[model samples]
Target: MNQTTAGVADDLDPDIRRFQREMAAAYGRYPDFDRLPLTERRRIAEEVRAPWAAGGPVMHSTETLNVGPFGVRIRIHRPDARQVLPALIYVHGGGWTLFSLDTHDRLMREYAARAGVAVVGIDYSLSPEAKFPRALDEIVSVVRWLRSEGAAHGLDPQRIAIGGDSAGGNLSVAANLALLRDGDAPLSAILVNYGAFDRESVYPSYERYDGPEYNLTTAEMAVFWANYLRGAQDFSDPLASPMRAEVAGLPPTFFAVAACDVLADENRAMADRLRAAGVPVMLREYAGATHSFLEAVSISPLADRAFAEASTWLAAQISANNDNDSQ
Candidate 1:
């Protein structure tokens, strides 16, 4: 709580401060993941870290569709009218095992309503249930399904984007790579918010922030990947860890990183790789923030502001692409 660095000092956004305190109280009992058994940790994630639905935009309706091998449940957030708006496929972050569409309901609704686009939240199969490649496969299939049937939902098929936070961000990048690798439908843009893009080696942040109540930690990350990979030693595979992928010609991207999150370095590294590959990219690092900030809409004003910034960036890209094509 460095007042000078964070600005506002004691005048911290009331909502944000309250949310942080609530989170601290919630996880106070279970401070260290290492102490808890795997089952207990999972239980805490599901039962304790559940996100509160916030007030902002209203969703017209929720439609569930089973389109993947595991009967993947996808939630669609439709806008008020039946206009052909751009659509963003959102994936929630929980280290690929905990959070789902239910935890991110408010964030998705805000994205759809504020971005003025249809949002499809993908409930991809989780680890120890479907594992790494399985979840990746489900996400890829959902994107393909959208490309085939998006027009029916008043969505412009060509204006589809894919994005998510943390593990979901990893999947967003993986799904796009799968599309390109298989010569399937290509996404127009990719949005990765504080994505955990590297798992093979722990970065500097991991060493610096491995404590509890900070939201995500380096030690917790090791546990996540242990469950996520399950001894499948292909961490360097570009699809699983997009940081290692050849970014030479991937789609345009928007990367949002939190200042204090352990995953901050890897997300920034991925952004640099994308830029090196000549891809059009917008990279933003929010100061004085932690991982998974975007989903905790009730607690983080920075999260809401971050989402709005992402929407603006996405709109600009869509508009820019549209203009380029018309020329």
Candidate 2:
């Protein structure tokens, strides 16, 4: 099959298609990757992603620290020498089963540099081992910690946002909802990049883009959901599926939707729901983009554009928050 029709639509951006091919080539090396043990699968995944995570803009300083009772490890990337900086608490996506702070290092650095804010990537407990609420709780704890003690590390506690891609995106919203429920202070913003919001209902985009050509398949998502949930009962929990939650009072949200992704329609629905709830929303859909396309920054100009756009929005949100605080 040609690049256009290999695993996605004919309109798939050529650069993104090349990214898919590169990813496929990486996975091709491990023909039995799916059959491997989770530990082995993760090892291979990290190795596969190492090159993509390399050679990004160097940080002014990077620090790794363990926080909370569960000892969640977080990597903080400061873009400049500023003593205090706004922060984006980033969660890395791997179906809640794979990927980590290291695998997503470059993406975090890119955001930190581009947005001129600190980017904090957390090493939340993974699924099947930690399960739902565990990762969500860790994220919530990190945010709380930043609120209480972040100033010691040069973070502006009042100007904090949380974001992630795929599974991480799901956790970002879940954590925000949890904080809201507990009557904790609200976040400044939420950034979601093609988040998997609902696991119970399969949307139209799922069927439309239900092939490996798009980089994410229905079967793979099923496995991911299975790994993250304790049982079928968890499906209805808003924390498990923020799409089913009461989204009122959420802070401003920016959605980076990928047109060819299975999560596209749901992302649109989410943006609509957030708007209906009276939440400020900025929804941008990238034509011909697929899930996880942001990682293609090294090879795709589209990915660079996406990052730049998100960074600009993020910077503006933080700036707006700062201005309000000053006023």
Candidate 3:
């Protein structure tokens, strides 16, 4: 509520400005996301949903895809035109425990429409029930299936891109590496949003932005890590924690970070590493925002802008890659 902070908040569009204020008033103290009771957690999530569901962009699409090990169900958002389009494989965030395609339908729809591509939202198996490697396996299977069957769905295998928020973001990166290591068809690009990359909280952003309605926190992240990693040995596995893996020769990447998220530094570090490895990387950090802002599509312009940047970057990369291939 100081002069400088207030000034920055004022810069947001009116709806986002109000949302920022309301979010602060309600949970400004940074309560641990994992500490809240199930009922309370659902309540807060619903509260966040009201605004967007009321007046937000409507994404049109065909049937949902039910393709995975154990019959995992995923939703697909397709654009209107008939010509085959590039595919954007999307994953939703819930610390690998809570969320599903339903929780993030709107966000995926918006991404598909604005980015002008087909978006496949994967409902990867959750934790405590299925555990690690299960979700990862499911996502990889679906992507491979998409590559094999994408033509039937009017999707171009050459323009395949993976994207997701938070835990989903983590999966997106892991999926990219999984495909590359296994020698599966290469993805053209990746869109990682506030991904849970590093397990350790050594990054300054973890300490600096570790508070209140800003969304992600160190304590909450620990809970996610615990649920994700049933044992300490799992952390060392490259498939489980991508930041610990070798990222060389991966596809082009687009990373978006909320300045207020505790994971910001790790994301930045990942970007630096990817760039050093000679991969084309686009990293955009939105100021005065917190984690999950993109899900708040109705209110946060930062979310909209971040999506815009990702879409633009993807278009350019895909086009350039195509141009080069035809040479």
Point to the candidate with the largest lDDT: 2
**For residue 222, what is the lDDT in candidate 2?**
86
* Candidate 2 residue pairs that clash: 7-213
Q: Ranking by TM-score, best first?
A: 2, 1, 3
Q: Model 2 over residues 141-201: C-alpha lDDT tens digits?
A: 8998999999999999999999999998999988889998999867889989999999854
Q: All candidates: CA RMSD in angstroms? A: 4.3, 2.5, 4.3
TM-scores, all models, native as reference:
0.87, 0.96, 0.86
Model 3 has an lDDT value of 0.74
Q: List clashing residue pairs in candidate 3.
A: 30-212
Ranking the candidates on lDDT from highest down gives 2, 3, 1
Question: Which portions of model 3 show Cα errors greater than 4 Å?
Answer: 1-17, 20-55, 319-321, 324-327
lDDT (10s digit) by residue, model 1, range 163-249: 998888999988888887897745888889889888855577766544443457666677678768746566668887788787665
Considering lDDT, which of the candidate structures 1 and 3 is the better prediction for this target?
A: 3
